[model samples]
Target: MTISVERAFGLLRIVCEADRPPRFSDIVGISGLPKSTVNRLLATLGDQGLVRFDVEDKCYRPGFGLLSLAAGTWAGLDIRRAAADEMAAMLAELGETVHLAVLDGDEIIYLDKLESAQSIRLFSAVGKRGPVYCTGIGKAILAELDEAQREAIIAGLAPRPYTAHTLTSPETLRAELEAIHRRGCAYDMEEHEEGIRCVAVAIRNFRGEPIAGLSVTSTASRLAGTRMTDEIRPRILAAGRRISAALGHLPTPC
Candidate 1:
């Protein structure tokens, strides 16, 4: 049976929005499409290697084919290439691990990292995924979301505590997100991982939607004693603003 390309794309959206790989029932619940139709779409997408189902986990996630697509897209307007010098400068100035990330569903996918020269540094690899509820880059991007979208994403989350300081309660996490909006920046207070702290600010496009985030991370010992909020926040915000400007975002009246 021939399927419409648009409908196939619609099914793809459901998997893309999910945090963990979603179960068949979960996809059915969210997409509101008929079960048979959804199953057919999933099968087609899986056959094309655009999605993969884990037999043991009984869940579906994006597949390597999507990475190929991303690589092609990235090759054209590579944010890492465009922003590397600025990130390097920031890393030099701050002597902390600098990261560039973009939102992928309810997660932040780290695209690039600039390690600090400091002897004591927090190690993070490029291509790492962090929860949007706890990481600084995640919060920075989340702050750009409207209430409804934010609530919907949270509704779909299965909060797994990564550390003692992680925000496990939805209510508490929402409140912290609110504070991040108020402050025009976000912080990772050992939420995603113990002993690590990070600060971040959002980069927006011409439409004012957050397209990326820039962050600086270190051990709690370094961030706790330093005046990071006062000193580093402005620098991070400046970098984000510059990137947004490069993406043609003009400041609108708040």
Candidate 2:
């Protein structure tokens, strides 16, 4: 079953990445699979609307089902371009690494990052996934979510100690999240990576739901003492508000 599934995806890749729509022969040749297996898998893919047989061109092309999937994915997240300027400005002001990430299931996925000019900076990259219960970006986002959703996420978490400072107990993490909610920001005090610290705030959509998180990260020495609260926290919180507003979120009247 696994081999069959792999072969199916193998054929699907050949069709999807071709310069033009690929014919049956093209897929078989590119995939190096038997003709019978290719034909059977193509039929299965066509049935699922992942690929289609183009009558006029007599070639395989990506199907409307894939477009439907893509649309659903793209509809929820479109904040990168809107966030670029704010990230750049934050990086310039702090001379620290800036990251934009979104919650994906039980993890946080980095979407964009602005490199710090300083010789010392946190090690991270766009597309990297990190534990939701530990990182500043993840905790900030969790703090902003509705209680039911937040509880559900917390209940499902399997946390471990990444560093001595890491909060491994669910009860302790719950308390930390509550504090983040009150402060409107979250902090990672060398919890995930030793010698690294960061401040993060939630980026919301028009519905006022946290769709992403924005964070400024630097070495512990750089962010030590009152710097995180007096400097980094306020700036990142302001940037989050601007980016959320750009995405059409309106803050509730206080």
Candidate 3:
């Protein structure tokens, strides 16, 4: 296992340094590995899309897998770093948990979570993924998607009622999305977890499409009064706007 890993990285480095895609014979010569061993390693890499084999030219180069992996890592860091101060401010002002998440297919994956000081706070973690139909962040992002795209995603989801407040009906969820669009925000009224509620706004991209969502979660009783609208709504929207601007949201010319 160790030998294979070392050889694979060895081949990867060799390919990376080449002026152009290196031929099979060139790799074998440079790596000092047997031709058969080099071929096996290259084949394994090709299957994983870690290396692109140019059959026509009979050469090897780095593949989309590497690019995709690197891009995702950098993008996650960019969002987390950019939103650090804003999330901290929210945490301080409300003394509640704040979350940063991005849409991953039909789910919203929490990338960064800042827990509140209180003992009874929202239950979640950095790697946690949840249903788009029930969570505030997920619904916020889902609201901004195009009709066809939204419908496609909804067709795949089988909404389960996590609580009585959970929007289970497809028709009902569609209506909720419409309201969210008009209001430019979404709410979790104890939908995913009883006693917890959230208010969130979409973080749009340069093309004015939702790329992520930001939210604050607190106990339902605390958010029930004027706090939800007078306080949380504007604060979250302001942060969402800042994040959207950072993401290069240039409004389209009419």
lDDT of 1: 0.85
Q: Lowest-lDDT window of 10 residues in candidate 1?
A: 116-125
Cα lDDT tens digits, model 1, 155-219, are: 98888988988888989988998999998899998888888899999888767888889999888
Candidate ordering by TM-score (highest first): 2, 3, 1
Total clashing residue pairs per candidate?
A: 0, 0, 0
| lDDT per residue (tens digit) for residues 161-242 in model 3 | 9998999999999999999999989999999999999999888876788988999998888789888888999999999988
Compared with the true structure, all predictions reach lDDT values of: 0.85, 0.91, 0.90
Candidate RMSDs in Å, in order, are: 14.2, 13.9, 9.9
Please provide TM-scores, in order, for all candidate models, with all chains considered together.
Answer: 0.67, 0.70, 0.69
Q: Model 1: how large is the Cα RMSD against the reference?
A: 14.2
Clash count, candidate 1: 0
Error of 3 at 41 (Å): 46
- For model 3, state the Cα shift of residue 15 in Å: 35
Q: Roughly what TM-score does model 1 have, to 2 decimal places?
A: 0.67
Identify the runs in model 3 with alpha carbons over 4 angstroms from their true place: 1-77, 252-254
